[model samples]
Structures are given as structure tokens and as C-alpha cells.
Target: MPGKTKRSGDLATALAALAGLSYLPPVAAAPLTFASPPAEIAKAVLDDEPGTVAVGIWRNQQGRFALQRNPVGSVGEVVEDDSAHAQPLFEIGSISKVFTGLLLAQAVERGDLSLDDTLGKLLEAKATLKPETAAITLRQLVTHSACLPREPQDFPGYGTPNPFSRHDRWKIYAGLSGMTLEHAPPCGAAYSNLGMGLVGQLLSDHYAKPWDVLVRENITGPLGMRDTMQYLGRQASRLATGYQHEALQGPWDFDALSGAGALRSTAPDLLLLARALMAGRAGPLGPAAERALTPLGYFRGDEIGYAILIRGPAGHRTYHHDGLTGGYRTLLAFAPDTQEAVAILASNSHASPVKVLTGITASRYPIAPATQMAPAPAALAEYGGVYQADKDTSFTFVAQDGKLYRRSTGTGFRALSPGGPDTFVDADAGARYVFSREAGEIVRVDYYLGDSGFGGFSSFSGVAGLRTKEAAPPVAVVSLDTQLDYAGHYRARRIIRTDLDLDVRAENGQLGVRAGNWFRRPVFPVAGKPDRFAYENGRSQLQFERDAAGHVAGVVLYENGVIRLRRLP
Candidate 1:
């Protein structure tokens, strides 16, 4: 951590000392001479970070905004004079989920909608829905417990820009017909983009206006958030250039899914939102904002209220959310108890502005480049444990060689780089972990990451979330002939999308399933379920559907629910 008075050499020494007695090599041949950072996280220090970073700070009812654009490893004493310029717009990504959630709350407050209102009642005139789908409530969609899949599988692919653009009112209405209630409604509070998008659709229809129009009429217009909008139109020039790694990326647009992550805005504009949220009953959307911030249930490692994640105890809680699209990244956080808020918008996809946010609030900035020497072996052991999230989410962290490693099913531990004291960074997952200590002993570890859903920073006190056994051994494979028996073209019977079909074949006698338009993916048989196969590392499953004659008639694909496909004759 660099204080306004701390020298560069002191920072290196401090970084080295974080790993106990281990020595660390210098990150650069010669320390870059730079002017002293501000005593507070003013514009000077914010400029020190790489890429384009726009930040908004609200404290004691005053709002301050700052923006900085510097290449990696280029920041030194001389700060770029960009502070006087206008704050550019940014694609705020999943932070839009929060706004969508707030929209639902606003409707609830106005008596136009009820959290308990069934999907059937809301869409009875607009679209036909399966019995199970119709029973889903407005609250489940807002809280991401609607049992909807994470996203629509009928897209070009995850790599394509504007992946959700294909989704519209028709598909949303039609998709409900395929719903199969394998699990009860409000299924375990997992993150679901589809669920929130549906909320946006229902709200839009209920108001007899487009989704964006509804948002403006109910929330943004009342709060005077002019720049926060669904469409850029003539404001395109004000939108900053977004980047993913070294390549410049294009902006994203959506149709019906716009409610999930379609809005774009400035840091200053976002701070206005935080202000309204912190004001609670005193704000314009007081009742809705208050209800939006209510802690309803657990998601990941913390309590969730609408689309925001709440941490800390009682009145001191901090409500936060992260938004990530291909080219932009964003974080919006506010504390009602202290009336403090921070909104960060980064132009580069790779920038971690949470460092800036946490740095300003906690006064603890992370070590840059982020690699560090291993702590003593004895010190590393304290971090080993298992952790769980959202009921179905879980992982294990193993301490080794001064680095803690983690994996979904608890084996195959990939190394995590240390960021700061008791903090670990998982770059792949885009998350940061911090451990807490009591009486010189590790007590709890907390972390948060961006996703399609609103799981807040998860805290595992001691090993409570992670105290678990090892993963089970690999399941035995069935005979090769048995695998070959299932090889054939399986066309979706009722699902209306190109991404609906699957081709199963035996390559070198091992069964592989090519789903939709993508290349073939290998399948693993589930343990104790001989007829079923799992793929995409078990995020999806396939169970061959058969008739009374014992002939394979089709296949049922299981993601969040079952979608049936018929075998081509």
C-alpha cells in the first residue's frame, strides 16, 4: 500500500514483507520516478492505475467524479490533466441487472405489480406459458430464483458480440412452453440472466411501453439521470472506446434481454443511483429503493436484496454489484449506514476497478502486477479449506507453495496469486478473496466475482462454508458397444432454434455429443446413472428417451430444466 508519504522503495519492501521472510525480486529494473500520490485517493492516485478509469465518490451528500487513462506500467509522478474533461459514457454491463431489479421494486411500491404475482397473471394476455412456468412469481425473477437457465442457449455462441440480441418478446414468450418443473420454483437462488430479462419484459408490458421507456418513466426520469439510457443514438461519440485485452471491441446492444444488461452510463450518473439507494425512504424511489435493498435470502456467501449483494451486519451493510461485458467492466457500491458510495467504470475489459473502490474506502490498495513471494509453508496452510455458494455453488482451496489454489469440484487445484494481506486473486474467474483473522488465527475468508446473477461477496467464516471432504473418484465408463448404441442424430422436437439439435457419435469408440451448431463436446456418464450422460463439465446432461419397444426415440437435455429432442430415423 502506498500512502501519500510512502516512497516507492518502501512499497517494494512492504510487498516483500507480505510473504513473511521471503525475498522478492524487483518488478522493474529501476523504480519509475513519479510525483507523490494525493493524501487521499484524489485524481492523482486514480491516474496511477492502468487503462481508462472513471470513478464517482459520494460522501456526506457531496459527489466527486474523476477519470484517468494511462497505459499499464506507464504511471509516474506526472498526472495526466484529464480531470477537467467531461466524463465519457461506458457500457455498464450486468449493473443493468440492478436497475432491472429496482424497476420491479418500483412497480411493487406503485401497486401495479406484486412480488407474489404469478407469471401466468402477468402474461396471460401477452403469451402462452406452461403450467409450471406460469406459477413463477415476480419476486423469483427479481431474486434470480425463478429456476430459469443462466441464459438462452439459442445464440450464435458465447464469443459472439451481442449474444442476447437474438432474444425478443416472441422467444421469451415461446421459451416458457418448454419449461419442465423438475425442481420446485425459486430454485436455490442461482444466478439467471433469463429470469431478470423476463422481469423486464413483464414490467414493460404492464406499463404499456417499451422496457427502456418504462425504466425512464419510473426511475431515471424521477432521479434526473439523463445520461443513463438504453440507446446511445447521437451520444455515440461520448461513449468511450471499450477494449478486451489489446484489441478494441465494439459496444453491445440487446432486444428483450436489454433488461438484463443493456444500459450504459457515466460514473457520475451511477453515483446518482447510489444516492437514491442510500437515501432509502427519503429518496424519490424511497419505498422501492428500501424494498430493493432488503436482505431476502443468501446468494453465494452473503445476503441478497433484489439484484444487489449486501455485506456487513445490520445498519452498517454495504450493497454492491459488478457488471462485466466483453469490452467494459463496472462496479457500483453504496452503504446506507454511512451514506458512502463508489461507482467505477473502466474502459478496458481487464481493469479491476474494485481495487480503486476498495483502495479509496478501506485505504488498502493492492500490489500491482499482483504476483508475490510465497509465505512460509506454515503460514500457507491456514488458507486451505472448502467453500460453498448459492446452495449449488462450491469449491475447495488448497494452500501450497505460498499460493492458495481452487477448483469447482475440489480437486485439480489451480494456483491463485496473492494480492495483498490475506487476499487472493483469481484472474480467470475475475474475483478477489480476502481472509479475516481473530486472535492471530484465520477465522473467515470472503470473495466476490462478476457473473450473470447477483451473488454478493461470499464469506466463509473459518472453514464453515469449505469444511468438506475431497471429491469422489471418477465414475467408471460403460462398455464401448453401449456407447455406440446411443450414437445418432438427435433433433429437437419442439425447441424452435438452430442451436437445438445434437449429433452423438463414437470417435475412437468414445461417445461425443455435438450440441447445436458448436463443435462436438465429450460426454461423461453420471455415477450410478447408466443411461444418462453429462457434458460441458456437467453443467448440462443428456438422458436418452425411449419408447415401450425399448428403442431410443429421443434424448432429453438437462440444463436448468429438460428440453426434449427426437432421434432422426
Candidate 2:
């Protein structure tokens, strides 16, 4: 809310009317030249990020170029209103988990699959996946460390609006052979989009083909790519169509989570798959997909790590990955000792391609900023203990004034903001945190939630509803006959007792609910003190527990997982 400052005579009468139209200086367009980009830092890194509209930036390994678009942002029905000859086409979510990690490193270099093969020898008849996830392998499902079960349990019956209907991939692997287990395998590095959509359903059930025609016959027609594939309405004619600072869409077709957030392409076919996975040289991943991009671990702590299909900065270690559905946002990177690589892709789902590829890899490769040292006061009390990432989660931080704040880690002390000098910044802005010092001492930190998914309740944690700023719960007014009997619909049932339904309604005087389309709404009661509630999408709160004949009997549901529903009948 801090924007009202202009009163030095209204900023000297708006700088004397912009100093008389600044002698007509509006010409722009020629300053960017890293092979042509500066169309205003490419429209502030893709239409100033409010549900962007086309932005492609690839560098090196031959696919060198910068693509642009923004006229009014929309990718499908062409509302890039001539943002300089728009040519959208995106989706590329999960950067299609690097073509399902190069189709499982080309079936482990054609010895036909065996990254320690298991999943109890790849099933598909009386089907099964959980027997402690059949001793997970296939290199722990392309390095997500195969702890399996990131999804399935009929993911809310997959919000079916043709959610890639092939009878919804046999009800999403018959609901992933009935779910269980949330941690184990390599346990630490959790990013799984159902572990790369089960390595694109185990490379389309071992190439009996149909994971988008085996990734268009083993990786987009042998990297000729031509507007890539994995249907967006059969490549909605050079697709793109997607945006979200409220609406305007097109291009979202995940057909069986198309091996983890489907692919569509065009950043010149992801710079020919990031110059053949940063040139370990020659395509479908050799040198074992460059040893499956070496990086697993750090699932949390500072927030980023998983190796295969790379991420942020790598080989000084950063390797990255990012993608989102419902409007596309993609990012891919490589740094294996700086042969350097990057990919951005954006149509817009809050386009923040990891701060546009970490400010374009620090403005086209600059690095060299790590020289701060000297601040260790007795290893700041072993960086103030308590780290705990899973075991009902934990987080603490507190080395006060000598830096390191994060206190109330169970959702309160967000503090950690810096980005180097031992990195920081989480509560998901695609999470981050890296420390590991030693001779100067902090030892180990690592938590990088980037390459998405650890997701749930995020306005990127600005500690929604100001959590412990104390005193807020006390608003609930109700009574106009309990707001007209809590406004209507009401169906209830599914809070995991399963058969689905749920609904619950009550408009104008608010209330809402939904369940499958995952809705929520209600928040009202702004000034008085009655029973407390919130959720106009984020800052999700809701009190209403009653039972001394006060009527309501159910609802505790605090933000990410506290649920409690009841009140049936």
C-alpha cells in the first residue's frame, strides 16, 4: 500500500509536464542486441509479468535468439494484438520433464531400460505400484528419488473437463494402483509431478507407444522439433494461447499429465533440447544423459535440487527446472562447469521464469559475486540449530542481528531474504536457500523448492493474513436468519471418505466451497467480532466449530492442511 508519495508540489507539477514531452524521445528497439532483445528488456522480461504473453530467450549451442510478444497479452485468439508478429506456442510445462528425462535416458541407452530397473519389473496387468513402491528405481524415476505417491488417490477425480481423456489414462493409472507412502526412496529431493508422470508412464508402457507417440518418436521427431508436440488441441496451429492476470486463455492439454505437465515447445524447440542437454554431445542423452544431470537432494532447507532435466545454475551447482500448467511458465538451465545453457518460454501463468532465469543468468553470465566472508561469530551458534524438513515438518533459524532470522519457522519467521553470501529467499518465490560453508562455517543448508511442487497455499508466503502480527480473528456477523440459511446448495461428504461431491454454497452474503474444482471464496465480516473467517482465495482461514447448540459443528481448516470438516446430515 505504500504508493502515495508525490507531493513536492505534485512532483514539481509532474516534472513540469515531463519537461515538455521530453523533446519527443519515443523511439526505442535497438539496444538489446545479444542477438536482438532490448524491446524494453523484452517488455520488462515478458510483459511485466502479470500473466505474460510470449517470451522466449535461448542462448548458445546454436539456437541463439530472443523472441517476443505482448501487445495486450493472450496467446490463442491472438490478442497479442500484433505485439510484433506474435507466434505463441508454449505449454512446455515440466519442460516435459526434459522429455521424461530423455525418455529415461533413451531406455538407459538402449539396453532397453535399467537404471537399476524395478517397480517390481514394470507392471500393467493386475497392475500395482505400491509395495513400498516396488523398490523404486529407473534411477529413482529420473532422479525425483522415486518416493512415489506425489499424486494418485484419484487426485480429486481429476477435475475432468476432458483432463486428457483416454478414459483419463485409465483413471490415472487406476488411481496409481491405490496410493500410500509420502517419503522414502532418496527421500530428500521431493519434486515429483507424480515423478515425471511415471516417466511418461514408463515410457508409454515400455514403448508399446503412446505417450504422445513416444514423445513424437523418441523426442520430437529426432529434434527437428517443428513446433514440437504432445497436443494442445493437436498443436492448436502453433499454439500459445494462455494468460492469467485474471483471464484470457488457450493451450492447456495435459493428456494424462502428459509425462508431467505436457510439452508443446518453440523457443526454437527448447534450443534443440538445450543444445542436446548441454552437449554431452549428440541427442537422446549419452554419457547417461550426462549422468542424469547430476543433482538430487536438498529437497528442502534452502529449497532447490533434483538433477535430471536441470535447473538454475549447475556445476558450481544450480541446475534448474520449472513449468506450470493453466497458462504455461517454463525455465530450464545448465551450468555444468559453465558450458552454460538456458531456456525461458512463457505465455503466462504469472510468468516468473525463475526471475526470468535468474535475471538472465545474471545478465548473460557474469557470476563472480561471492566474496563476503568475515561474518561468523563462533559459527553463529551453529547457525542456531533446529532444521527438520520432514517428520511433521520443522524450521527455525534465529541467529539474530548477526543475520539469519527465520524464527517461528512453523509458518511465521519468513525473514531469510538475501540471494548470495550463502543464498536465501523462500516461502516459495520458487524457493531457495544455500549455505554449506565450513572453514568459515555454516556447514550445510540447501533448501531449493524450485523446479516446482511442494506447493500448496502460496501467495508465495508473505505470511498470509499476517499470521502472528497477533489479534485478527473476530469478525463473523451472520444472523439475517443465519445469513439466509448459509445461502443454498450444500452437498457435503468427500473429505476423503471418498465418493466425491462436497459443493456447499451461499453467495452474496458469501460462504462458497466446491471441492473438486477446488473452490473456496468466503471471507466477509470485516469489522466486528463474531466467529472469524477468511479465504477470498488466499490467506485461507476459517473458524466455525460450534456445538453447545450454537449449530455449526464443523470446520477448522487452517491453511495448508488442518482440514477438519464433519457437520454432515
Candidate 3:
């Protein structure tokens, strides 16, 4: 269904965040300075993208700087806001979850709720609950480990602009009553909108009030976030028009799931929120800020401090969260130690303003899309091999017609544009990939999804997704008969089922372990370690023991301790 669209770069922008992205290496990781007027940085964010963009940066003594890049009359240009002041409303989608989480923390501070309280305890009067549902605690819900699914059961029109238009309070409670969890509580930090939505609902139910109203009274009201609310009302005109794939989109509404992603605000107002978060418990945010930001669980491989994703290390810890809805994108990140923060709001749904913000916050210059050029086929051909990662995943690249393409899990044949000699970027944006070589031979590829998690999806920025050539799957297979001395079954009773049974089949020094088991994988020969093989692409290695007769007898794996598996007939 294609039509003459008014939106900018609809197809390219739509794929920006969800597509295959790689990471770039700046000169070094440091604070970005603003030599050119902040406007230049804002333009950098808007460069190579569509629509209006605005950001607010704050420092301890520096106060706050607001910059806006207004769309150039729906044309192919972007202009700085001549208004001199940033005041435009945009939907802060999942970011609303942090506010919901804040409410829970506030309730905890006020003795209105306990983190350990179960779902059944709060919603028993409103809805029936299964055993697992009843066991869900407030902590699990806020941390996104409640084991709840992404959406409520029997959700109507789940993928439309108005995903929760029909999901009112009644339906939410009804869905909760019979809800089932795939696993027990604290399910290892998988993002769950339904779980956070339930937190808002359960909190509102306890107080017998609306969830958004609670947000106003407890958070926005106290913090003077006047422009932040679910409904724009009088400020409706100020609300920027949101878009998806170059077509205009209507406002998104949430009845019971308002806590999940149902709030709109301006860059200044969000900057206020980030500032409050930086102040910690002693500040206007009260103990709730500290409570919400306390390390709780894992989120996208890092730490999830309640609703916020906590990154960096001690003294440099940063709290951040991003929101994306119908046609708007929002992000808020602040570091208490550096007393610095960044807030971004964009009207274009296709492009990611957050990645730009990521660059701005990381360096003094604006991070732009790498200008890609056609690379020589000889250069591309060297990258046409398989790379294995630690988490049972692999990346296979193919060079065809002077272009390099990737064959990965979900995405099929995404082209990688040359950003540098050994670096490539996704044409759709939101990703960058870098290649490394040792001794003039390509060794590993390091990449990131996008600068932001929009995550709990494919791309989360910051963390490196490393793939080593040494961990690559078998390329030149040799017949099993060639390694007859090592070709046999091995069993480990000490380890988990993962390595309980091993069928070592190899050729050309590559050993395929767990032949008949589910996680069957090839182990490459480890350098300087004779009779030893590696798996997880070299993250782990094991030694093959031979009996006195020189016949392969067993395999010994070294982890935290030795795990010996006897050779089986």
C-alpha cells in the first residue's frame, strides 16, 4: 500500500533503528564540548534525517542550554528555531514508564506501597489472578522481570497507532485475572510493557484514582512540570505533528496502560525531569528518585535501575531512558557525578535523535552519518566469512558486486556501507560496525544495535557486540574420517545438560561439539594449546585427553573449575 507521502525519508527512517547497525570509534571517549553554538550540534542531530528536533543539555554550574532544529517548511531542509526558546510538546512514549516506576517508588517512600507486595495483594478486589500472577512483586514489575508478556491478552488492534485505544481499565484488570507467566518472577530483565502497565494500574487501583492524575500530583506537580501530561489540551497547538514513514499520525492514547507509554512534554520540561533525577533523594524528587535509580536488575546487558537504564561505573554512573510512540521519539539521560544530562525530542519516527544525542554527549562535535563510498571488491571479499559471538550467535558476511551484505538471525542481506577502511554502517542509520585486524589479518568485528535500546529490541547502544574470527563456524569442512582418532561421543556428568553430552566431530582442526544436542556448535583449534579445542568462538576452550594407547579417551573443560567428561562408546 504505497501512496504519495508527505513524510520525509519514510522507508529509510523507518528502518533506521530496527535495522542492522554498527558502532563507530571516535578519537576517544570524553565529554563533548560546544565550540560552535549549540545550534550546530542540534543541526548535526538533524543532519541526514527528517523532521523537527530539539534538545536540552544541563551541567552543574553551566545550567541548561536549549536548542531546536525546526523542519524547513516540510521541505528538504532543517532550520534552527528562531524563537530562541525551546517550547514544543512531543510524546515521551516508554519514558512514561520511568514516571510510572517513580510513582511506585514514591509510594514506597510514603509507606503507601511495598516493593515486595504481590499483584494479588493490590488487585485482588479488582480482578482474579492465577498463582503465578499473584506471586508477582512490585520490584519485579518495575524492573521488567515480572515475567509478563509484552502485551495484554486478547489485545485488540495491537500493532496500530492506537494500540491501547480499546484497552481501558476494565479490560486491563480482566486481562490480569487470567494472565499467565511463562516463567517465575524476576525473569532476567526482559522488557515487559504489560508488567509496567500493571504497576500503574495496581497503584491507581489501590488509591482508587486515575494513574495520570497520580503522576501529576506526585511527580509533575511537585517538580513544576507544567507542560508534561498525557493530554495536550490548551497546548495542543504547540504539540508538534508526529509522523511515521513520511505519513502523518494521530495522537496515541492509553486507557489503563498509560503508565507504559502515555505522556507528552517539551525538551525543557524533560530537562527538568532529568535534573530532578540527578539531584537524587535529597532533592525535590524525594526518596523516590534514589529508590527508582537503585540498581535492580539487568537491562540489555547493563544495569536496570528500576525503570531507568544505569550505565558507566561508580562515580560516573549515568541514568537514562528512551521513549518512542506513534510518531514521536524522546530520550532523557543524566549523570549525577558529572552533573550533566541530555534530553532529546524529535517529531520524525523514522530517524533516531537519540543516537545524535549519544554522539553529542560523548564528543564536542556532532556525530553524522558516515559518508559511504563504494569499496573495492577485493576489500569486500575479505569480510565474506562467518564470525561467532559469545551468546550462541554468529554473523556471516557475503561480498557480491562490490557490496558487502550480512546474513544474520532476523535481517536478510543488509548492505554495509564503507565508513572506514575496516568500518561499515547500515544505510538505514542507527548502527555502525568496525573491524579489527591483528598481524594484517581481520580478526574481530565490533558493533552496536543503535545508540538507544528503543531496546529491549535488537539494538542497544554503548555495549559492544563482539564477534571474533577465531570463533567462526567451520568454513572448510574436512570429513569426520580424517579425525577418526578424536571422532567419538563424550559425556560430562558434572556439568549441566549444556555439555552433558558431547559428540566431537571435526575436520581441519575444527571440532563440532554437542553433535546431537540442541546447542550443537563447532570448536576451533586454540593456538599453542595442543589437543585443545575452543567453543563460543574462542571464549572457551577444552582439552581432549588420550589414554596410554594414544586413543581419545575424554575431554576436560576448564571454567571456574575442571569438568571432566568420559569418552562414551
Candidate 4:
């Protein structure tokens, strides 16, 4: 029952407090003026596309404009957002990692923790860690090239609706410690949520304090970021309501992984921090700020490069991070060279403030095309239908009330609109997903996030591989007899050997199976396919093998590899 609901009670408390509170009246004064912003910049901000909410520009500590604008709407929609008074205290997610990095840099400055220290050395001799991961260094974690897998093989508490709960954090870490490494650390760059969370743990150990408290004392408290909180708690009133598409959605609180993406702050507070970072002599980070943003390595993209905690794009190098929770999207960007920063927070999960924010740095902000023509309903309808790349991988495009929606097998579809016959716009970010057809049939799907291109997918013609299929209806629907025989922990011995477990139960006409340490998803049987059943962690796949007697015997779990389990009591 607890797992079924995603909304946090803490978030609700925060909202209740915010309900009666009101901001001071706006100054009847003109907009804060220091210098003339580019005319094109103003137009891009004003002509905000659909799915966008708040847009602000701060240049050289002089010109600042806080404009409330809605995507694809009249001035009233913009006015409703109240950009002038829209307190931007939303969870900025991984952007909080940058703050954690600053704390680490400060620690190194004080001779408390060194960047060169390996993870094994940081932990007390009593704390257990896998032998392979002992070589993982703090430096590798910062650069995101630790080659650490993104999550523990058996981690289940991840992606919960109310991810900030105490139940999620302790359960997830306990599960992770029991797991094995997918690759050795420092082998190559692998973006990992687990690796970042471990950094928080290490920092906590080094300071002999809690991770959240350490962050507050070293960074947030010093920067005067009163609104940022790792847990939603009773402070939700100042937080903006998060939305999925257009409807209000539940909140996300990363309690255990606070170092990875747990802090929430307003735009003004973020800009204040950015201004300090640019000044290079602010609070706890004074004189040691340069070490935090130095280039570590290339990012996972083509256009820009990554340096440890810093991301360099084109002419400017910035300390940046963006967050993507279910119904909320947040962005924070600051030019390390110019001391100019822009924070865009959108309540709508479909909203994309990144394009508008990044354009300021690139000098090519997106403007609505002057010539606009609505596509014919019939024309848009033709793009609808399922498209397959392989038997194992397929995408579907369904036409809903004249608008097109796209989805993959295990993922949900978001509404998309037309830009051209071959191109369609992502309703959220205004990015393009282009299609190329062969003999009037789509063959390739290419995605572009602004000017940066995301590679395309092509159909793999007639390759021999296991194809997913729905099993036919069972001839005999009988309850499973082996209940007590199958109850207990089963370790994944081959691939990860993550000491994961499975619990079995017989109820009402069928067998129910629950697996994983933290997050438990229901495992349903494959109809008429003997012991085979569908198991979905993040992605779903068929599992279980039958013995010669047609009884469930060796269990083969497929997730990047085949993990077998011999039944144990």
C-alpha cells in the first residue's frame, strides 16, 4: 500500500504552509535595469514556446529580467505564472552534485580529504566494500568516469513515486553493499547515480557528520540558501507545484542519495551562489573554487566536453547540472568566466527550460519561426503507428485526438507535434525528432536536442535473436503447489552476484513473486509458458526455466546477462 502512492506527505506539509503565505507587493518601479540586453534575446524569452514556464536572464550583474511566460499562449497565461513573484525553490536534482563537489574541494583545501584518496581508504576498516571497488578513487567519482554501473544490480528503491522516504534509502544501500561490481572503477566514464551517492557517504564519514548537515554547514548555510532542503519535510509551502504534462504530479525526494540530487533552491539563491563562484572568493569556497570546476574529461556527448565537476560548451565553461524527475524539470547554468548565471525551473515535466537557458551561452536562443502553418489532420495521422528497429526493440507512434504520441516498449509516450512532414517537435523542449522514409515508409528516426543531434535508429533486417512474445492463454489455471519450498534469499552468482532475493507466495489462483532488496516489483507468470514469467526492474523481460517434470527449477534472470538461481529454502 505504501509503494502504491508516490506523493510525499512531507511535500504536502510544505504546500500547506505555503498556502496562506504571501510575498511582498511588487515595486511599482521599472524592471531592474543595468544594461541593454540583446534585442533578439528579449524576443526569444518573450516568445516562449509551449511546455515552458519561467525564463530569466542575468547579464554582467547589471541587466536582470524575470519574465513569466507560458509556451504557446496569450499574455494572460504569462501573467498567470507571475514570473516576478514565482519563487523558484524547486529541486534542481543532480545540480546539487555541483554543490557536493564544492564541499569536497573545500575539504581537500582544509587537509581533511584528498582528491587522490581511494574509496577503500576513506571508509572505516569496519565498513564492508567489495574487493574490486576498493580501487575506486574520489577523483573517479567526481569526473563520472569511474566505470561504476549506474545503479546496484538489485537496487529497487530507485524510481519510487515518493523516493525521499526513509524506507527507500536504507533498503537501497543495504542492497547495494551486497552486490558486486559490473566493471572496475577508473576503467572509463560511466554516468552513475550510485557512484555519486557514495561520494555523499564518503563525505559524511570524513566529517563525522550527516551528509545533509555537512552540506548545509559548508555550502547552503554559508551561501544563504534558506530554501534548499534534502528532505521535503514541512517546508513544502515555498515549493512550486510540479506537473506531469499539464496535470499536477507527485514529488521526488532522494533522501539516501542526497549528494546525487536532493537539494531544492530558488533561482535567486542559485544565482547568488553562481555569482559567488564566479567571484572566486566567496565563503567556504574562497580561493579553492577553481579546483572544483576544472576539466575532468569528455562528457558522453559530441558537442561539448566535461571537466570533473565543470561542463564546457563552445566559448563558455559553466558549472551546471539539470534535474528530471517525473513531473518536474529544473536547470541551473553559470558561466565560470563571466559570473553570469541563469536558472530556469518548470513545474511541467514536459517543459524544457534548458534550450532557452543554454541559448544565452551559445548566443542562439530559439525563436518561434515567423512563418507558421498548421498541418492537416490527415497529414499528421499518417505518422502514427508502431515502428520496429528489431524484434527486441520497437517504437510506437499513436495518433491521439489529432496529436501524435510516441513510446517504446516499457516506456510511456508523451505527446508530440509537427514541425514538418519529416520532422516533429518534442512538446516539452521544442527539440526535433526527424524521420526518413523508404518507399513512403519510415526507416530511420533521428532526434535532435536543439542544435545537438542525438543519433538515429535503423531496423536490423532479419537477425536471429530471442524475440519477445505474449504467451497464449493457459489450458489449466491451477495454483502453484511449491510455496514454502521457494521462499528465501537467492544470490545472483554469475554476472553481478548481488545477493538479491526472491519471495514466493500462492494466492487466489496464481503464484506471486517479489524480488530485489529495496524496490519490489510484482513478477507475473507468462501464460502457458511453463515456469516463465515477466520480471521488470526498469525494463521487463521473460524469466524462469522449467525442470523436466515441468516444475519451476533453475531461475534465469536476464538483465544485461543471464543470472541463474538454484532454489534454496
Runs in model 4 deviating more than 4 A are 1-52, 63-76, 79-88, 157-159, 164-173, 232-234, 281-284, 302-315, 357-361, 364-569
Model 1, residue 284: displacement in angstroms? 2.4
Deviating ranges (above 4 Å) for candidate 3:
1-37, 48-50, 63-86, 157-159, 360-569
Expressed as tens digits, the lDDT of each residue in 1-569 for candidate 4 is 01122333222211211110100101111221112242323233333323334444457554253434344334324332223344555766667777777778778778888777886677546346686666777878776767675554443432455454442445544654565776776654445666777788678767788788997887778778776677667877766666553345567666556677777776666766676677765534686566666655544321212223333343455555666554556666667556566666665544444444334322331323323344566766556555553322344555545556654433334456666656665423323456777688655565443333212111221111121233212221223454333434455554554465555544322344545412123344455565555542324543565568865565777756766776664
Q: Model 1, stretches more than 4 Å misplaced? A: 1-51, 71-85, 356-393, 399-569
User: How high a TM-score does candidate 3 get?
Assistant: 0.62
Count of backbone collisions in candidate 1: 6
TM-score against native, each model = 0.62, 0.27, 0.62, 0.54
lDDT of 3: 0.63
How does candidate 4 fare on TM-score?
A: 0.54
How close to the true structure is residue 118 of candidate 3, measured as C-alpha lDDT? Answer: 90
Give the Å error, residue 355, model 3. Answer: 1.2
Candidate 2 local lDDT, 196-313, one digit each (tens): 6776877787777778888787667776776777765655766656654334545556655578766777655665666666666454555655645655433332223223433333
Count of backbone clashes, every candidate in sequence: 6, 25, 11, 13
TM-score of predicted structure 2? 0.27
The Cα RMSD in angstroms, rounded to one decimal, for candidate 4 relative to the true structure is: 16.7
TM-score of 1: 0.62
